[model samples]
Target: MTVLDQRALNRATLARQMLLDRADLPVADAVAHLCGLQAQEPQEPYVGLWSRLRAFDPAVLSDLLVRRRLVRTHLMRRTVHLLAADDVLAWRTRHDAMLRQRVLGVYRGEFDGVDLDELAAAAREVLADGEPRTNAEIVSVLAARWPDPDRRALGEIVLALVPTVQAPPRGLWRTTAGVRTVALARWLGSDADPAGPDGDDPPGRALVRRYLAAFGPAASADLRAWCGLAGLPAAVAAVRDELVAFRDARGRTLLDLPGAPRPDPDTPAPIRFLPAFDNAVLGYHDRSRIIDDAHRNLSVAGARFVLVDGRVAATWTVDEGVVVVTPLRAFTRAERTAAAEEGAALASFLSEGENHRVRVAAG
Candidate 1:
C-alpha cells in the first residue's frame, strides 16, 4: 500500500476542492462538482463559490435559485445545503433515513407515542396544496394533532419526514429572508427518485463516486462523516473494485478514484478565503490534510478561514464592510502580502466592488 503523507494529502485536497487554482467552471457545474456547498448561513455559498470559481457572479446563483435550477435543502448530514436541483432530487431519498434518525435523536422522547408514518402523511397533507409555509406555520397547523414535542422540534421533524426545500429568496445571493419551505416535488416540478429495489442501493454507490471525486483519498470513516450515513460501508465494499487505495500517515486506508487529480505535494497553493461551514475543511473525518488538529474545532465553530499554503492559518470576518483577518499564527512577509491581495478582492466581491478595504491584524 502507498503511504500518503499530510502534504501530499493537502495538495490533493486543494486541487480537488478547486482552491489550488481557481476554476473556470460555470457556477452550476462548480456546485455539482463540489457535490454541494454548506449553506446553513444562507449567504455563505456565494463566498465559497467566489473562492473557487475564477469569474463567479453572485447574481447567477441567485437567479438559479429563482429559476429552480438550484435549491436549498436539508441533505448530507441533515444540515442545510445549496445543491443542484437535479442532484437534490436524485439524492434526497437516500438520505431520508439519516435525516429522520438525526431529528428523532434530538426529540425522541417528544415523539414516544407518535406514529412516524402517520406524522409524515399528516404533514404531506398540509403541503399537498403546494403552499409554502414557514416552520412555525407548519408546526402550528400540526399542534392540535401532536402538541407534546417542542414546536421547534416538531417543525424540524416534519421537514425531515416530508421531502421539503427552503424556497427561493431564502438562499438568494445578498438577499436576507426568513426560511419558507415547499414540498420538494412541488418546488422542483419533479419527484425525488425512489430508492433502488431490495438488495441494492444505487444512490449510495453514486454518492461514493461523487464524494471521492471531490473529497477522496479518504477513509470509510471520512465518507460516513461527510454524508452522515452509516449504511455506506456496503456501498464502499461494492465499489472497492472501482477505486485505488493508499494509506495515510495514521495507517488508515484511503480510497480514491484512479483518475482524480492528486497534484504534486509541493504545488504552490494560493491563499483562499473559505466561508463558514465550507466542506473543504468539514468534509473529512480527519481534516489534517487542510487544517491542523489543534484548529479542528474551528471547522465546526462556523469560522470563515484563510488558507495559507493550503492549510488554515487565520480566521476572517467582515466589519463595516472591511475584510478583517486575524492570523492564527505568524505569517511570512510574502504570505501577508498575498493574504492582503486576496482579502481586498473578497471585500470587493462582497460589497459589489464598492469596498475593498482589508485589515490583517498583527500576528
Candidate 2:
C-alpha cells in the first residue's frame, strides 16, 4: 500500500475542507457539504461559513434559520451543530442511541431507577404544544414527574431522549439569544426516519459515506472520533469494497472515496481563519494532518485559530473591534503580511466595516 506522509495528508485535508480555495457554493449547500458546523457558540457558524464560502453574507445564514432551511441541534457527539434541515431529519434517528448513551455516561448514577422510556414520553408530552422552551423551563416541568434526578440532570436526560432543534434567534448571525428547543419534527415538519441500513453493516452506512465526502481518507478510528459512533466498523467493512485504501506514515490504514480530491503535497494553501471547534481540525482521531500534536489541545479549548500554509499557526481574537493575533511560532515576513491581510478582512466582516485594523503581536 502507498504511504501518505503528513504534508500529503495536510494538502488533502485542505482540499476536502474547502480551505485550499474559497468555494462559490451557497451557504446552505456548504453547510450540507461540511455535514454541519459545531455551533455551541451561536455566532460561530457564520464565521465557519465565511471562511469557506465566497461572498458569504451573514444575513443569508440567518435567513436560512428563519426559513427552516437550516437548523441548530444536538447531533454527532451530542454537541450543538448547525445542520441542514434535511440532513438533520434524515440522520437524527440514527444518532438517537449514541446521544442517549453519551448523556447517561455523565449522569448514570442519578438515573439509576428512572425509567427512561417513560421519562421520554412525559418529556414529549411537555413539548407537544409546539411552543419553544428553554432548558430550565422544560426541566422545571419534568421535575414534577421525575424528581429523583435534579433539575439539571433531568433536563440533560430529557434532551438526550427527545430529538430537538434549538430554535432560531439562538443561532442567528450576530444575534445573541438564549437556547430554546422544540421537537425536531415540529421544526422540520417531518419525523426523522431514514430508510433501513442497505447492507449488513447498519443504518449508519450512509453516514460513513457522507463523512468521507467531507472529511475522508480517514481511519475507522477517525470516523468514530468524528461522529462519536462506536459501531461503524461493521459499516466500514460493508463499504470497504467501494473505497480505496492507503497507509499513512503511521502505518494506519486510511480510506477514501476513489474520486475525492487529493491535491499535490506542495499545493499552495492560503491563510484562512477558522472558528472555534471547527471540524477540519477535530474531524479525525489523528489530527497531525492539519494541526501539530502539541497544539491538539487548542482545538478542544475552543480557540479560534489562524491557518498559515494550511496548518494552525496562531490564536486570534477581537478586541475593541480589532483582530488580535498571537502567533504560536515565528512566521516568515511574507507569511506575516498574508496573515495580516486576511485578518483585516475577517475583522471587517465581524465588525461590519467599523474595524479592519489587525494588530499582529511582534514575535
In order of listing, the candidates' clash counts read 0, 0
Runs off by more than 4 Å, candidate 1: none
What are the TM-scores, per candidate, against the unseen true structure? 0.99, 0.97
lDDT of 1 by residue, 1-363 (tens): 999999999999899999999999999999999999999999999999999998899999999989989889999989999999989988999889899999989887888889989999999988988888888888888989998888988998998899998997798877889999899998888889998853587888999999999998899999999989988877888899999999999999999999999999988999999999999999999999999989999889999999999999999999999999999999999999999999999999999999889999999
RMSD of each: 0.9, 1.3
lDDT by residue for model 2 (250-302), tens: 89999999999999999899999999999999899999988998999999999
Worst 10 residues of 1 by lDDT: 195-204
Give Cα-based local distance difference scores for all models: 0.92, 0.89
What C-alpha lDDT, on a 0 to 100 scale, does residue 265 get in candidate 2?
A: 92
User: In candidate 1, how many Å is residue 287 off?
Assistant: 0.6
TM-score winner: 1
Give me the displacement of residue 351 in model 2, in angstroms: 1.1
Residue 250, model 2: Cα distance from true site in angstroms = 0.6
